[model samples]
Target: MSSRLYILLLVLLIATGGCRRGTDAPGIPEYDFMPLEAGRYRIYDVQETQYARNTLPLQHSYRLKETVGPAYTDVSGHRAYRLLRYRQTSNSLSWQPDSIWSVRLVNNEVIRTENGRDFVSLLYPVSNGLRWNGNRYNLWQSEEYEARNVGQPFSVSGKEFGETVTVIASNDSTLIGQTKRVDIYAHQIGMIYKERTYLQFCTDTPACLGKNQIEYGIRQIYRIQTYGKE
Candidate 1:
């Protein structure tokens, strides 16, 4: 490569390095705060949206509960059992949850459950009290990077209530770089609604160029009444 070309490439590489705070790519933005905090309230949205996945619309419903101890309702959404509890903690402006079964977070490093079982960890975001994990890793970054890396940039066309952002990252060979879009909901800022969809996507499949759109909606009825003496 020519000396001039090499210098230009080096510059590009340096700029693209993940070392630059939040410089993942040309469009990712780094966030400026710790994501997890304590004393935060979160409203779980169950099933409030819909879309066609593989050309067929899917109708799925599930229930979840936040127990106070090492127990939770069973899969039937009717039976209760002794499983584990989740403890929420935080510092200046972030909330971290400690589960009763396995997994914990200390000094930024995440530790899995002591038992030899597969379990997911939960941590709250700095923007009040939103819970997320590695599966939703982009939540740790700014809106720009979060939208770019994990999902897609929030566009006006995708806006809804209070800037709803949806992202899907799949490794299926038949759908590489398939399709990603971010729905922005900036209107319903304070009023937490009953139903909302977090993610939606449609990608091509096989040589037939068949398209599929899958979406996960939360039709939940929860409240987020703030607590503590402010």
Candidate 2:
């Protein structure tokens, strides 16, 4: 072979090798905040506090267990996973059926539907400061949800998680203050903690006959006690 032809072939080989390396490079790290598989379940200790208009705050504690059921197609033709929720009061030994929740991953986004309302739980390429409308399809209220403290260490219920993502959902404005809902998800596991607090009290001095005049509100807290997959 001619010297120029040999040099040309060598150049082509180098270019091809570079292209191959570029194609074989490692992809973006997968954030397993929500691993959807059958038989995966998580148990949580839940505390619910209710604040009525003219009544004192009442608190109730319970145990909540959620399990992933079989996969199925929904009415909208999307492949979805069923979640069975069970709850047990403090004095109850047997768990009672609370409700059934459904979720699906579409276009790399986790979508959950409850009570005919669709919510975008998590988005792809999960990173800090990621924001989305969690209640976009809901008619009652539009909530702005943001991902904060992504891939951060978190501890709850005597367990330490290497990486956790916290999503905060809040309404624009309310009668009293901002209504916020927070969810914390651990890597390789699902949600480990959740909190929702909303309180509206009568601020007007004349309308407020007493100092404890809460119109309506509720506070809920859930902490993961244990989780496993099968």
Candidate 3:
């Protein structure tokens, strides 16, 4: 086991799947899908629906901004980026800090941490219809994510992207409730659109017999508004 041999093997690992980043090349494989750089930011329009039993559903709209602050080595010795999230409700309202999250690339997969929960966002060689467990790294129930509509053109907020990929995180529905989570990413841009729903409906009664009547739940959508480097 010589130093030269070890170094060679390490280089091969990196070239294969160690990290999605190398020397900032024009086309850096998966980097286009999950870009990780400092000072880059994106603004999104958010819509949420809340429901409660015996009450009308409440609709809320707001704006969210996510900025990549800086890169630092994490406990696992991998380079990670600090993600800062801001929220605003109205044009007159100033952006306020909402939360702090982190994103890192391990091997060939992208991991994003939110609220102390790790979720695998994407993997290398992103082929259409590829599936993987997004919660494999965390101590949670196994949740599968499938990549669809790869290398397709999409439009959002009057912006047209030549290439995009959609990840179906969850899709389940029953007579009583439904839970669906989806995210769309554009080439050179990050996540362009996101939608999630977790709703429970009425049951065992005439009014709630079909379970179509909502009892309580939450639905949310996020659409990209503006994005650029700072």
Q: How many residue pairs collide in each prediction?
A: 29, 0, 0
How would you encode candidate 2's per-residue C-alpha lDDT over 1-230 as one tens digit per residue? Answer: 99999999999999999999989985423887888888999999999999876677898999999999999998889888999999988644888999999888887678987776789998877889988878777777777789999989999998899999998876434445447688999998999999888877676666674444677788899999999985
Considering TM-score, which of the candidate structures 1 and 2 is the better prediction for this target?
Answer: 2
Candidate 2 local lDDT, residue 83: 90
Ranking by lDDT: 3, 2, 1
TM-scores, each model vs. reference = 0.27, 0.81, 0.87
- The better candidate by TM-score, 2 or 3, is 3
List, residue by residue over 65-109, the lDDT tens digit for candidate 3: 999989999998998998999999997989999999999988778
**Candidate 2 overall lDDT versus native:** 0.84
Model 2 off-target regions past 4 Å? 1-29, 139-141, 171-175, 204-213
lDDT winner among the candidates? 3
For model 2, give the 10-residue run with minimal summed lDDT.
171-180
lDDT at position 61, candidate 3? 97
The superposed Cα distance between candidate 2 and the true structure at residue 214, in angstroms, equals: 2.5
Candidate 1 per-residue lDDT, tens place, 115-170, comes to 43322222222232233333433324322212222122333223333333322222
**Decoy 2 TM-score against native:** 0.81
- The residue ranges of model 3 lying beyond 4 angstroms of the native Cα positions read 1-27
Error of 1 at 68 (Å): 5.4
